[model samples]
Target chain A: MSEIRWDLVKQNWVAVAANRALKPNDFPIAKMGLKAPAAGGFCPFCEGNENFTPPEITAYRPKSQANEKGWLVRAIPNKFSAFTLEGELVKTDSGIFSCYNGLGEHEVIIEDPRHGVEFHDLSPERIETVLNIFKERYQDLSSDARIKYIQIYKNRGMFAGASLEHCHSQIVGLPFVPQENSGLPKYYRDNNRCLLCDMLAQETASEERLICKTDHFTLICPYAPRFPYETWIVPQRHCEHFADINEEEVRDLARVLKKLTGVIMDCLDNPSYNLVFNTAPVNVEPEAGYHWYMELTPRLLVNAAVEIAAGIYMNPVAPELSAAMLREIMS
Target chain B: MSEIRWDLVKQNWVAVAANRALKPNDFPIAKMGLKAPAAGGFCPFCEGNENFTPPEITAYRPKSQANEKGWLVRAIPNKFSAFTLEGELVKTDSGIFSCYNGLGEHEVIIEDPRHGVEFHDLSPERIETVLNIFKERYQDLSSDARIKYIQIYKNRGMFAGASLEHCHSQIVGLPFVPQENSGLPKYYRDNNRCLLCDMLAQETASEERLICKTDHFTLICPYAPRFPYETWIVPQRHCEHFADINEEEVRDLARVLKKLTGVIMDCLDNPSYNLVFNTAPVNVEPEAGYHWYMELTPRLLVNAAVEIAAGIYMNPVAPELSAAMLREIMS
Candidate 1:
């Protein structure tokens, strides 16, 4: 079991997972991104090299068998799981210090069977299949008593933190809720409303920061984005989790998400980016406090040393301006 | 005046300053770091090219005039400052949204007149001179009621966010204290003790994560670090700010910091890194809540897509192991 150590100063938990099996010297010579796919190059997530990865947990197969070449997408346990399935989560508090066993699940959803394929290349139907699979996985693991938060996010390029060139999204069932969702519950307590709901109302009314709106989703550039082209996809229904999103909503979301990402790729010249699903904790109580959404942040600048170290950002571009550019490109 | 907008979801402020004058088109072609300094490079911070930079705010001049040829170190307003000296800081709140004018100070401390020099290349006494200038700047503006926090940090390599090849550190005086300093006040209210002080006691008592301890400073690997080889330098005197340190303490810190950076460079193959000073807000009330410290984090890895997008981190290396390695290298 991995140990989640609580940072006394950060007031956050740091999970020390041994699944990566990294040595002390690995830090000095860690190579990122995939090698060229030509000339006998091997990739674990590729079609013929399925044996290099852990067995498939689930897959969307139309003609072939599990872990076979016919699959369009598949979910596998992370080779180095940050949180494993077999562990007892026992919180230990000594004075002001606290820690717990890292007891949950870390899985990867390989978006495409073909290596080096980008997300935008996938059809809306294929993206819809991926979303459906993600929903199934969320609903599948929500019943587990140990898991509290599930984060589903994608990293597109090396600068965006993708270690491999294969198109994949990660799903991690954490034992506790990370601070990203704290605002919703707190806003509900203070204002008796969902935070994103009010934000949607404000952005829609103004439309200054609005990029585009679909039947079920509203995409807008957040008012205070840390990144240059940071945008959010908020569901109009104010749902608490992605698992709760219906079939129709999922289809609409797939279209909205696909178009937005494509626009970003065209506008930013295909910059590295991260896409995250901000869902409520598993079985959030008084669920009106939360409104689940998807956030896309482009890694526009490479010099984030200041932002990373100080946690203070000096954004060169305004969200209003970025939204206008995105809307222009989107049209 | 630049605008500092509040993020409802992140519960943080985002400053949009014109100092950089970055248009939306710049996002597609912004190059980080610097070109090779070989072909008679024109660095505004270089010794002979001082006229290219904004006029000097202050400098350590045993010879030559202000912004002139001979100076070990100098402080000047950033050519594209994130915050500025001319603006009326006003908070505007409507419903749940809030914003303020980006009215503060952003200065660059050219640590060396020579281009492409590393901090470790400077002598301890020379580093002490730099530290003294940082303290002088901190105390200089701390009296202004509009300024609430001061951040002094260095981004060494391109990966670590340095835009120029010249050796330099940044000093930003903000109109508000950032969330980095929020933990101290919260802990003080709950525990009636400084958080870093308590952490120091635990790390010192165990010495498992201790790298090196001096009379005035204790350098240790934080138990929970977001980055690989992250170390913290906590002052022993329980001071609330770096400006509060004495002359002897400054000299001691300069020596300790120099040694640590040297060891890190030697061990990590001269990895790009960020060093930050976490000082308290100006004139903190019931000052027991804060303790000043410096943190050094190596940019050993480039894939921060997950850490940046989601606030969760899975640190593969444990602090104990990293500290052991550092100690071994130092010995």
Candidate 2:
């Protein structure tokens, strides 16, 4: 489980997970983009090694038992979760600092049962199943009054912070809305327009930063990317929540994601990357200005002090160039 | 040099450094935290290899000629700078996007001629010299009307994004104030109190999070630290600019920094770290609420999607515990 603490100076909440020292393997010494060791030996996410992990919370194993080997996908609680559901969500003051019990849910979505499979190699059907699980979890977690936001993300390689060499994604249901989402609702209230929608219209129209487009989705390198070869997969229509996505959107997203990720792996020589889902908070009423999107950042370079101190990013590769390269590869 | 791009969607500015791909050495494939390859082979930052880099911008070489091997500390324009002084500082709108010619200064401060020498190993007098160079550069750059903020940071070890093995620091002058500093002045205006001064009072009074204290400065693990073992060196008295540091403060800071960094290396077994200096923007009038500080973050864990998307940090090691460990080691 984890405890949430309020940063008095920065005015933000920090989740502190316990038992981090117990998992020494999570902190790798290797440079991030290298191929992680195959999970053939003592792999927890492997189908037969289900016993190594905590019991399954939910799985798409229609034909097999709850914790059996016949599942295409599975969901389990993170063993060393940053936030947990054990303690009551009570806020306490320690001098000038405010802290809450580590009260939230942390779950891992096993993309596949294979030992060393990557998400791009997964079949569209399997990816769709993963998307379905994400939506299901988002909906279920939103029902809890205590959970304000559910963050869904995937760390592909060691550099992107993937401790286990397995095809998996994480879902953290937090007790408070993250700082990034705080100003979004107000923007919608003031402008009556979705910021992403306006940007997407311009990006697609220019076609300079657009990598690919499908019926329901558009993929483009962001104008001001934080990392080199940073890409975004945005829904064609404005949608506030990931759970509100339709079946067509899900299927299209799966196909687009598979193609885009394959291109990224090929273009960047299989760079370590992080894929994050940005959606509106559950507690807030869905607003027109809030649009759900996914940002894919390739870990091509290391972040230095400028990034940490100023919140300013220095990207080496221009988005236009990266997008042109991806477009050429896709063609 | 670097080009500045505006992220209309996120409402932030990004610096895009060009010619990055030409320098493959900047992107190392070896595992982080490992002893980088020694300075024996074609080390651009080494003293004798002055021809390998651009001519020195400024150096402390009193006995030796310019571009010669006689300097103890040297300053040079970054060969592959993210932002440069080559362009006119003009912002133009392209559709919904705004971009400016990357019109700023980027310099590298060679801390020592020896390769693989960490900051903690340096003598206090040498550290003071380095601090003097930083203040000198800050004061010099502030005279340029085009520059707003000067970011001083050091990326040590491979994971901390130090591409070169030699001990050095970077200074980047930007055309605009970063998003992180934008709120502080307004907060000060509204509350009529210096946020950091209040924080220092609370932290020093509590003593739980205080790692150490000198006559001029206090080192404490912030109550809401974004990373594990994150520490800040804050001055005892309120100071808005790094250039305002006096001779005595510089000497004390050098001593405190040496001791604190040594404690960190001892406690974390020489973990990769990033050290950053945060100060008020030059364009703004100095305010009582704005206090200058330096932050040191150890790269103990990898940041995944939740951190990137939500702006929420999950620190596994609590500040209090880490502070206590450092205090114990110091004793």
Q: What TM-score would every model get versus the actual structure?
A: 0.95, 0.93
Cα lDDT, all candidates: 0.80, 0.80
> Listing candidates in order, what is each one's chain A TM-score?
0.93, 0.93
What docking grade applies to model 1?
A: medium
DockQ of each model vs. true complex: 0.51, 0.54
DockQ value for model 2: 0.54
Highest-scoring model, DockQ: 2
**Model 2 CA deviation exceeding 4 Å by range:** A18-26, A30-40, A86-88, A181-190, B18-26, B29-40, B86-88, B181-187
True lDDT of residue B255, candidate 1:
90
Question: How well is each residue in B1-331 modelled by candidate 2, as lDDT tens digits?
Answer: 5668876556556887643432223446323333355544567887788888889878887699988998888889998777767646887788756788888888999988877677899999999999999999999999988888999999887668777778899999988888665445656877787777877888878888888777899888887788888899999888889999999999999998888888777767667799989888896555556688999898876666777667778787777787887777755
Model 1, A1-331: lDDT tens digits are 5678877676656786533435534642234333446667778888877888999999998988887678899999998776777857788775556677778898999999887688988899999999999999999889887788888999777567676778899998987777876778888988988888898898889888898888888888887788888889999997888899999998998888788888878877777888999888884454558888988988776645456645667688877787887877775
**What proportion of the real contacts between chains A and B does each prediction keep?**
0.48, 0.59
Ten residues in sequence with the least summed lDDT for candidate 1 chain A: A27-36
Residue-level lDDT for A60 in candidate 1: 94
